[model samples]
Target: MGFTTPTPIQEQAIPIILSKSDLIGCAQTGTGKTAAFLLPLLHLLTEANAGTEEENPKIKALVLVPTRELAGQIDQAMEGFSYFTPVSNLAIYGGGDGAGFEREKMALTRGSDVVVATPGKMLQHLRMGYVDFSQLQFLILDEADRMLDMGFVEDIRQIISHCPKERQTLFFSATMPPKIRELAKEILVEPEEINIAISKPSEKITQAAFSVPTGLKVELIKYLLSVKSVPNCIIFCSTKKSTKDLERELNSLDIKATAMHSDLEQVDREKALLQFKSGEYTVLVATDIMARGIDIKGVALVINFEVPRDAEDYVHRIGRTARADSRGVAFTLVAPDEQRDLFKIESLIEMEIQKVAIPPEIGDSPPFDEGNRRRGGGGRGGSRGRGHNGRGGGNRGGGGGRGGRSGSGRGRKPAGNRR
Candidate 1:
């Protein structure tokens, strides 16, 4: 009865989600989003499960999240909230070693009440006749934007097609993007919507970007970690190779850091996460692929060792900090060539990121623009072909909707904002 007081997003979304109506919730991350959906799903299941036969209750709930980390995180939350009730659950993700999952199969196959799974791995079991979704009554798609961005549309469709169309549906994402909106129309009927988008970074986090030369990013990271106040931090790289290289450099510098990426074995990745969580490591450098579902607490800083390519990713990267009412900082190291991309990020999020002057000791230099001269270099240009100098021109090619609209060119703002 005493789940922490509702955040604004939760206050608005939970009731609607519990009312047996389809819902689209647009809210920034770290706002008790998991609870907003989990609470209602639990309320529904706890009643259905009470005094019911345990051996064959039939799977009543399914949560499909965008990443493996999120699937595990949500499954844990479900167990925590439903502790005293008859509800049971399982977390299924890809890349885990066979033995770890094999231990959990008994609980999973015993007709547990809820299943949290990643789309690809769940499909493997569904096709093999291991999981039957015929009686599934609730479907929650968490981090819907990232799912669409990562090309999960077909898998999502297949999963939905397998479920009962009359059941309640809940879709949550930090950003709506057009593709998510269209998908919502297809899956949800007469949906209630809630949007709590904080276009700016969280106040607890002091955000600033440094202009650095691409080659010197690792050096800059080394220097940042040298600072006395550097607490638990995550260094974000756009690719796996960079993550490994950076890990090597940090270890060489006597910094306790590890890389968490898809390349690692599932057990190794889980070990890395647990080590970072238990204070055995100070830094966890990772690629954006694992951004959405990691829920580590007390993360004092998030450093974008490599700036993200999309504004949504920038938000996801920064989300690791300022969680659960704790203040944190997110710093981005931007190279000169990436200035334009940073500008695009600003435009997409509708907020200005403060610029941090590089300390002379780092020797990071701004890159020369096409004009063959050094420039102040701020702000991503607009979609309408306007340069930083305010020169107006035609719209950029292949530009149509907010947050990369595709298909028919019609994109709806995330669920609740339309009101």
Candidate 2:
């Protein structure tokens, strides 16, 4: 909302939080939820400064997110809002070398009024006595649902166990699950609920799913790329190997895409994100782990090369497209083995996506046909073609700016199939 007006989520949420009550906000991504909490948070902290009239500051606010990308995104947003004010902040996460993160943590310890962190890295620091939150006055669990889904409940519980009980707590998530609701009750103090009504995927996006034999997925993807005036899109895969393989195959077919996940170095992740945001690539191949944290704007399409294991994951993936009140599309390629998972996802979202017709020419070979395999099919060991693997590329502009059209990278790693 730089020069523009606030979104519905922001408008509804900002005022309620400004009253100093704890809140639970359930809204979709791209609804401006970030500003809803950030605005009130900054205002409250700045006002606290006037009352105390102090030159030094203690850690007053803590934001715990699920991923490094989100921590960075929130940190950047805080910096922008606190630009004119004296309230400074820092973002902390893992994936950086130990020494660099340690130095940054020390810098944060010295003066930052707010600290945003991921659970794993934050736990590492807390147990080693590198930082303390006993005096922490405010706590926020952004994307609380994702944290629980990522198996960080123990870490979150340990962190919150150390914070002052009297401190205010606010929990925000695109969607809330039963476990998150229980966790919210444990932490929040007389919380004022601010559940934003818009929790489902956008109606603007044309939702479609296709039940295809596993071998024909690549051919289907190729056919979709060839036919749909596909601008920039995201391809969701179940395995890192599939992600890397699909990316190499797409690039081989002149699709100009990139892969991102846990395996890439932090610096490379940052670079790949920047390039995608800058329109250096048209497609970003990734796994579901990266879904919630990827906040790119104006993504025209979301292609689930593999059906997600859970219904919630399906919502988040399609949420990447149809952002900022703009129109988008989502396609899912369901293999015969995944029919059950597909049914569960559709049931959770409470709507049936129409079946899409796949052209005959998409896959000419069997899905596991090693004979037709791209070079180095299984891992990142594949040669980096014309496109930059991580950092070695010049910025190339597409139709629009990166704000609404950025793509992302994901590392290769497999996760448990939905139970």
True-structure RMSD, every candidate: 10.0, 14.4
TM-score of each model, paired residue for residue: 0.85, 0.82
Q: Evaluated with TM-score, which candidate comes out highest?
A: 1
The residue-level lDDT of candidate 1 at 285 comes to: 90
Against the reference, the lDDT scores of all candidates come to 0.72, 0.70
- For residues 1-419, could you state the per-residue lDDT of candidate 2 as single tens digits? 45389876677667766766666777666678888888888887766554343333456778999988899999888777876666767778878687877776675555357789999888877787757664566788898878888899999988876676666677787665678677876776566665553435777889988868888887788788777876788889988888889989998988889888777888878887887778899888887756885688778889999887666678788888887768998999977566666666655655667865566555332232223123222221111121112211122212111111111111111111001
Candidate 1 local accuracy as lDDT?
A: 0.72
Clashes of each: 1, 12
Model 1 per-residue lDDT tens digits across residues 1-419: 45567887678777776666667777667878888888887786665444544445567778988878888788778777876665667777877667756644544455556788888877766666667666677888888888887788889888777776557777787766668777877777666777675555676778888888988888887877777366688889999999999899899989999889988887788889999999899999999965676788899989998778776678778888888778888888988767766766677555667887677888956842433112322333233211112111212222111110011111111111112
- Alpha-carbon RMSD, candidate 1: 10.0
TM-score, predicted candidate 2 vs. hidden true structure: 0.82
- Count backbone clashes in candidate 2: 12
